[model samples]
Target: MRGFGDAAVEEVPDPVAGPGEAVVDVACVQPSVTECMLLAGEPIAMHTVLAARLAEGPVRFGGHEFAGVVRALGPGAPDGIRVGDRVTAVETAPCGRCAACRASHPHACPSPAVLGFTGPGAFAEQVLVPARTLVRVPDGVTAAQAAAIQPLAGALHGHAAAAVHPGDSVLIIGAGVMGVLHTQVARHGNAGLVMVSGRSEAKRELAGRAGADLVMDAVGDVEAAVLAATGGVGADVVFEAAGAGTFELAARCVRRGGTIVMVSVLPDHAGAPLARLRERGITVVHPRSGGGVFEHALRLVARGDVDVDCLISHRLAGVEALPEALAITRDKQRYGALGPAQVDLFDWDRAA
Candidate 1:
């Protein structure tokens, strides 16, 4: 991004492997909706904090969800990491030399370089990532599918914090990729009743296919519908995957003593139903994105337990389409995009 709300493709130097890092020949990349919002200089927390630095320079941002073959490995890279390995990596890499790392509390690391947003990302033909974050893509998963697995890994991290158990009820707000993934994950956990709320009929239909027992139009009284579905009780767990605006609905739909897992990164000023949450003694949680969840997510995808292909609505070729793809993700409703628009940097079929 050149400045707030201005983005265009310009030729940038191709990334090269640095010590302890590797250069991935990006096969495919999918830009998250949040990335598009941030790139547009929305008043999201991330942009707000980085506004000054961004204003000082042209930044290469977005494309944390991607997969590719290892093109080059720098010296000191771990054993078993080699060129030609197909991999998808975790976006957030913790700084292991910090006080938090010394204390064995790596999650509290004060400074972590968020790939794409903080540094160069996978929006181009190659991206440099910490070798430690790489997760091998299984044989059967396509590059496009591997590119899309990062978000599923994030969903799995949230599900772990939700502490979902068999016979528990789940309500997911926003039938987007995370919502649908949560729906499928909840079902896999044998949740008694799984519900999803979406503003679009198409998304609702997709939610049903993802194993949501009930799909409610988000414009209507979602809390009432959730209550009705639970026989006067609210959902045992509510997933706020729809971003900041849906926090209130998540609060209202969750039963007293139930948990609310916030998967989306909301803005600093985003409204929350704190009073109601306090009154109900609701446990609100924001899950961190680690714990080997990517491995579990990969297994699920490889085993066909989660259906990612159906959520992909647009697939564009080459990095040149990134600008238009970002716009499509921004105007998702207009474009009928269920998830981030996938951009293929290299021909996966040809590689296969």
Candidate 2:
């Protein structure tokens, strides 16, 4: 296996799917999270990463969050999935026979081959995936929208478990993608107030567009700002999305009986201010994957209930533009990529 920070574009022959598989001309690539890991010299680092390419006929391409349309369907796949059908894909290649899968816990199967993180991914022109792996993109949905939905589903998993009640106020730490989704879900659940705390104004703007009512720049007295939003009552729910010194801010923002939802990966040493929670009788909501969360996320988009399109800030196509498009995220244009647009990966690949 290669060392971390060693991810480079290594070309392989065009793949042809065998029976029970489908070949999707990747229509879009969702960036941000995966690129963060790769930039840190950990090309293979991921939440649900598969082992590296072993004997190597079809090597890996590091894009797990993706969407596309089936260009060709292999034998044995149902005819309902025609060539022109648009779809989004996930990383879990579960063995349906496994105990975990039988219990609807495929994401946590002992052995799973995910799309880009673990297996061949959708970053390229054509991604070969099992027929069962793809989720049909609903009508009027763009590829970028679908691509973004996958992560939103993961975020929703935690939020749903927390069960934000109507008239409850929500406090979200970090205006990153996860934080944005948390705010959206909180609003959809009829939260009394949606407050987001983040470092950058740009992220705050994004959060607002995604339905946050009040935005707080957490550089100073974030905890106070949150309390003020609730008239000193504190928030009914808090989400630690930033995983920085945010636990204190989050813990302090919640009311006596409020709940805290941990949506993203936090450091091992990043301890929560548990004494506050214990004293307040606050519950910590920890949600796992599965539960057909993505399917629910798609339906939310289809209904136009969740304004996910507001969160997409950038869209780039083809291999040539990838390098520069990738750079904008780090420089002045980070998150400046605005207004959700459909990503057509097939067009980019064929053009390249």
Q: After superposing candidate 2 on the true structure, give the runs of residues whose Cα lies further than 4 Å from its correct spot.
A: 42-59, 231-233, 289-291, 323-344, 347-352
Model 1: weakest 10-residue lDDT segment is 47-56
* Model 2: lDDT of residue 36: 43
Model 2 earns a TM-score of 0.83
Clashing pairs in 1: none
TM-score per candidate, in order?
0.97, 0.83
TM-score between candidate 1 and the true structure? 0.97
Error of 1 at 250 (Å): 1.6
On TM-score, the leading prediction is: 1
Model 2, span 287-341: residue lDDT tens = 7654267778999988887867776666666744444444554342344654232
Encode model 1's per-residue lDDT on 1-352: one tens digit a residue. Answer: 8777787878888778888999998999988888888877778768765687676887887788999999999889888778888999988888999989889997898888788977888888989999988888888888888888888887887888889888999999998888888888888885889999988888889899988999999899998899999998899999998887889888888999999999877886888878899999999998888647887888899999998898889999988999988989888899988888899888656775
Residue-pair clashes, model 1 = 0
Query: How much lDDT does each candidate structure score?
Result: 0.87, 0.71
lDDT leader? 1
Candidate 1 deviant stretches above 4 angstroms: none
